[model samples]
Target: MMNDKSLDIETAEGNAQPPHLNFESSFPSENTQVQTNTSEQRSAYQWYVVIICMVAYILSFVDRQILSLMIEPIKQDLMLSDTQFSLLQGLAFSLFYAFMGVPIAALADKKSRIKIISAGIAFWSLATAACGLSKNFIQMFLARLGVGAGEAALSPAFYSIVADLFPKDKLGRALGVYAIGAFIGSGLAFLIGGYVIGLLKDVNFVVLPVIGEIKTWQLTFMIVGLPGVLLALLMILTVREPERKGLKVGEDGQIVKASFKNSVAFIKTHKKTFFCHFIGFSFYTMMLYSLLGWAPAFYMRNHGLDASQTGYILGIIILVANTAGALFCGWLIDFFSKRGYSDAAIRTGMIGCAALIIPSVLFTQVENMQLSFALIFVAMFFSTFPIPASAAATQMLTPNQLRAQVSAKFLLTSNLIALGIGTTAVALITDKYFENTVMVGNSISIVNAIAGVLGVFLLYKGCQYYRDSMKTENLSKS
Candidate 1:
């Protein structure tokens, strides 16, 4: 491996040749020891890239998740069942979002990531706004599917972009900061959604000049979705695509395409590690999506807090607590990884499972409302803790050629199961078994416990495989 002090110097100097420069002179590098210049990778333009990507990530979550806060309004508006609403929130979105990731990621692996991201941002933003125009459940469902398809193009590109932009030493922190979009966007979705709801609550209807005749929830979707269009334009204009380092590059300064077979072969070579880690993350995602998707409903049903009130409290907790936890976990992983404890990332994943299991399961059962809020806040923090470390670990394991596709496969499988299951399992319990909306709290507890147990088991089993994978990379880089 590159000496710690030398890499640190390289990082601080930020004056090395771009890694692609080396790859351009060579082809099919077997060693994958990319000597990226810290100067180029850590430049002002580089940081600009991460910051804008973070903003775009934040907006994506806002557009996608605003529906969670508007669940009741949408339910009443469309005259739907909890199961049907859950379909809109869960399976309908996940099916397209998860499945579409593979092809889009394959595209990202060969094409310009910025084009995919910018165009996707514009597409999803418009799709999110289209939800505002839906007068029926089918129309809303189809619009959400469009939103999912657009979002499918992002994360593969996002992770791949960040991996190329930052070196190994700084990747954890950078990705963690980027991952904050997940929590922060969700928080802002609630915050902005709530604030919008409050504004329109007293008024019967809102009428804009060009787009006349909209309701409260519809107005909220338009408010949250439209800004992203402008953000997408800014992204394409400003965010330069990072050169694909440690791989073959074309004359256009892009990575030469790797076949889908090559990506699958890579995964096949490390089946145990990839499978266990992917499963662990999927289980973790299950617990997370449930809390974010249904917690507002829980607050409304059990604690007598309305949408605005639930949004304010939960939004504060998610924005503050989850952000702190993600950054701290990122720092911890980087610190330990630098010290040669290469198992740091997955080990952190284990710790996150422990932290979330009890708190998340107990939060809904707590008798006191204040204590319940505190517990849920704690739960949210730990739920976010695994993301950065786990993602950094995965990125570290692969070369640029395989990174985006591997990430897409992980996203595809994980979201299909977790998003499909996590977001809907609670509602299934409430709608089918309990037959009461107030029973959503019980559903949350049950689902969290199950997924937590699964996460702990899978992550534990993967520890040795993770260590072995790290050692493999060390040898190659060295």
Candidate 2:
């Protein structure tokens, strides 16, 4: 392994190279060390950081997803329409979550990612607890915004950290492990949230110390949200930031400090690639969020199940199907990468999207519960492909300084479309077009069909664009 002095010299030597120099010739020794380290495999501490990051991600999703299972009770208590509830689920959270990521990720690029992530985990956990204290639509909306803002700090920073920790060969699996946290957390939210709802089913309200009387759903938020604070502390104490790799250099032989503007300029240099990646993955996530945010309600209303029952079933499906899919997709990306596919990430995404279309649209259209669930399992399995794919695509091509900012940009586009538009699009169609509440399944099917088709087409194009972008980075074999 390269020591700190050798690493500094490596960066300095690269900076000493001329502008427009061939990338492969600019850092021969660094490239050799990279190849050597790939064979050395990752250390125990590297895996430890990945595991801790995964835990944080798990908590983040649990807090975010628990609200889906509580739709009926929350709507009843707050006197909200489907549109209003959709705003809480989609617009209110996503608006801040998406936009805030850019600025927070800029900080992550320059600052200590571990600290940034720790602060974010602590803040979001508290915000999630605050969701329990919400008395009305506006209050819940505000609390959800806080949750979004806090969570905006996590992924961009985590992606940057993980990329620095692992080589390209092992990056997909590490990120895949982290991505599975989304499913694990969502699963727990549903499974445990269901069990809690069942326990609190007979009781309408709970009396807490000083807080007095509150709905059981409110208590559920508090239950799942608070443990994250401790996790944040654990991270702060244990995980040290890894050395930044693949940094860009200025003509003056100094490391280039990244800003949002620099990040955007870099994207413009590979405009077609990012356009396909950002927009394509946005459509994919549109299908994903629509399903995740509404599937519980689909089971409840369309399939004649209650909240607890819907939670239990969907939770199990999400846990089993989505988690496995994330892991398998990560390995699949590595599988393709090992075979010299420069567009492995996007290629994997296209495969998953193609397989996802029928299952996503048909799952809700089916009348039989077993058939619907089986289809849902398949849809969910493919839905997760973007998790590792998106991360790997961004990290693989971006400079270390700009990785977080670029990731934040992708998050902005993705969440805006997926959460803000996707979730609300379903509600709008159901309320205005269908003119019925119980026809949510139809709305789900329509959105998934449209989004899935667009997602596949764009990703298919993305494979070529991604390959071209890799060539631009001088990382492609072709």
Candidate 3:
């Protein structure tokens, strides 16, 4: 006879065996085991979800940027000052979009991200259409506010979704692909706006009791706004909710709730990465947003080009340069990561890009129109190349759990300071020096060049923090 403990162990091991594997069945089916493993992998549809999220992001950007191309026509019709126009493009829009993003992103962390995104698209699309109906500065300002409110839900929620869908190693490429939406949507806005305004230059619609005559600019807003409504419907009807990774299951099998305080705590613990990304992106946005918001008007006034011509030329440049920059940065970051030089890659790329920006901007102020445009294209290409690296750096520094909130925090700082203040600063400078467009342009260039230099310092600091964090993480794992 066997001892009690040995017999008990044998009995427990025997009980652990499945009935099919027991004497009741001589052999178990290999097909059944393979089917279970396949189901596990099928549980998460990562790439499909990334594609859908990217589509929603594209619509968000198109709605925001359509106004950039239409600014000239809108300014002419409304008789608006540069200061007022800047308000519409920057502060009026970015104020709500920046502040509202935090809470909405927090909600995305807790609720269904797909639902938040769908609702946001619908709200903003309707608001864009409402912009067409505005009779005065106040009405247009309010419409822009609505647009901002809707857009606030997009980036953070999308970032959260992307983080969940892709592994750490693949995230740079994933974000690069997603960022293409920004370039494509912005390019399409200018392309479509130019064509529509060109086609409808003489066409006027006299309809409705309250709204008598509608111009092409007004019609442009209405037409562009409608498509997002359909996109919103697609988002709501088709997209399945993804599971929130790293959540704990309780005794009753429900996901244990994560607190906002806990989220803040996580960020506080990683403050170095948080601040570095915030400043680097903030500086980058200051330059990009100001340029995007003002470039059309700048070209129209200084280059003596019609809105349609200016739109086409600038649109083509931005489309090509931005797309290439984003994709290249993504590739470089991923390439360097495999060699254990992720931080070094980001630091070198951003610093090099930032250093070139000063000269690039000065060159854009050159007297020759063709030369200026050519130089601006080069400046834009280099300026935007580091964007993907900055994005990846932000994602790498934060814990996976707080990625969305951290992104929101980064945007809040970047947008409020860069997008909000940068555009306004350029507009104010232009207005003060309105008598001398050349001087005005030079002033704007100087401000941007200084901001670019600051960005290099911030990026370098971020790289150091990233390396230190990686070391700490490695020791923890060991």
Candidate 4:
């Protein structure tokens, strides 16, 4: 039998009325406080779990980002417009990815997170391979949707697991290490995608056993996607679920699993902080996804570079610049935390938002290609700080039972506004306002400037709200 404490609160009004929580006096739990010991050093096993999780993250991004590098060919093969291609890259994946995260994360909060993550890796990997089988726009869109739905299961659970594994002092660095997978995967997607495109640019088609002939791009998807299945199996077999920490307990000494509604209630209590966090990060990511989605097209159209060359260059930049940035940002958050800054994560995010703007906009506006690349390198470096910072911010503030759900809420808002709207916005501007494919560079600059400015202003305000919210909660970190 499972622990009774994990049961949802049983009240006359059901979940609509959350169990009484008095943060002003103490944490919401009836008796027990959070169980994690901040002084304990993380073990070797914990590091292993983090490494496996990072590998899974790497594969997820590879599947998601590879499509960006194949835009021209996919459009040519499927007779798609720029807007239609953007839908496949942005909306089709993000719509389901964002919407599905809540229910999956709810399960993460209550069930075995290890199993959830493994299953997700398997599902998305297969979904990615399925994208290779698509022969039409509708088919591709559906495939992308499947990929999104499957990937929706990852980050929230990973964040929850990592939060349980490490102390608050070390949480940012651990998560920052995990965040490296995103850029690594993105880099690999471009590098491998570019290499494959170059290798097979001459080969028209190849015959499969039962499936008949397939395009080179189709083969590439299958190659990248199928390996994740084995990785999923490895995760299921090797990784053990970490103990849930900082959970609420009732008067009878049973842990209380916060209902979805309870999670919402907690969020409502700290609405200002969440509002700034969700919107600010969403806009920051809007700039990021826009650049990632369209940069290949920009280089190909404006700079007279082919797919392979652009991919190689961009891949190197992401691997070096973005990876370093993520690690530094993680360390930076931990540094701020150690120095008695309650708003460390938000403060770090504000710095990145402010620093990245000039370079982000100027990179595209510049004439010299090498100078443009240098600016891109600087922008890319600052762009990564928010990834770890945002996760650290949420994990530090929320109680254990509600961590995954709250993180999911942030993902839903961030992905929708960033990936869905932000990416599509660029395509719309290029297709309608500019009415010229070569003007995509301008579209990137405009979107970057608008999003960057908003991110800085909101995060600036968020620091104050975060500090206010911290005062109310009895966080372990404090």
TM-score of each: 0.88, 0.91, 0.85, 0.90
What lDDT does candidate 3 reach at residue 14? 81
Stretches of model 3 off by over 4 angstroms after superposition? 1-45, 204-211, 246-257, 342-352, 385-387, 433-440, 473-478
- True-structure Cα RMSD, model 2: 10.2
Q: What does candidate 3's lDDT look like per residue over 1-478, in tens digits?
A: 8999998788877886743466734555788779888776654456666667667667767777888888767788888977888899888888888888888878887788888988999999999899999888999999999999998888888777766666556777777777777777777778888888788767765364677788778888888887888888887887777666644344588653455676677667667866776777688667777667777777777778787887788788878977776676667667767656757445645654575576457754778988887777776666665546656666665554565676677777888988788888888887785555434466568667877877777777777776776565451111
Residue 395 alpha-carbon offset, candidate 4, angstroms: 0.3
lDDT of each residue in 408-452, candidate 2, tens digit only: 999999999999999999999999999999999999999999998
Q: Which RMSD values do the candidates have, in order?
A: 10.1, 10.2, 6.5, 13.3
**Model 4 ranges off by over 4 Å:** 1-42, 249-255, 476-478
Predicted structure 1: lDDT: 0.85
* Model 2: residues with Cα > 4 Å off, grouped in runs: 1-42, 250-253
- Model 4: per-residue lDDT, tens digit, 181-298? 9999999999999999999999988899998899999999988899999999999999988888888665589876667998898889899999999999999988888778898999
- List the lowest-lDDT window of 10 residues for candidate 4: 32-41
Q: After superposition, how far is residue 124 of candidate 3 from its true place, in Å?
A: 0.8
Q: Which residue pairs show collisions in model 1?
A: 14-38, 14-39, 15-39
Predicted model with the maximum TM-score: 2
Instruction: Tell how far residue 141 is off in model 2, in angstroms.
Output: 0.3
Clashing pairs in 2: none
User: Relative to the unseen true structure, what is the C-alpha lDDT of residue 211 in candidate 2, on a scale of 0 to 100?
Assistant: 97
If both were scored by lDDT, which would come out higher, candidate 1 or candidate 2?
Answer: 2
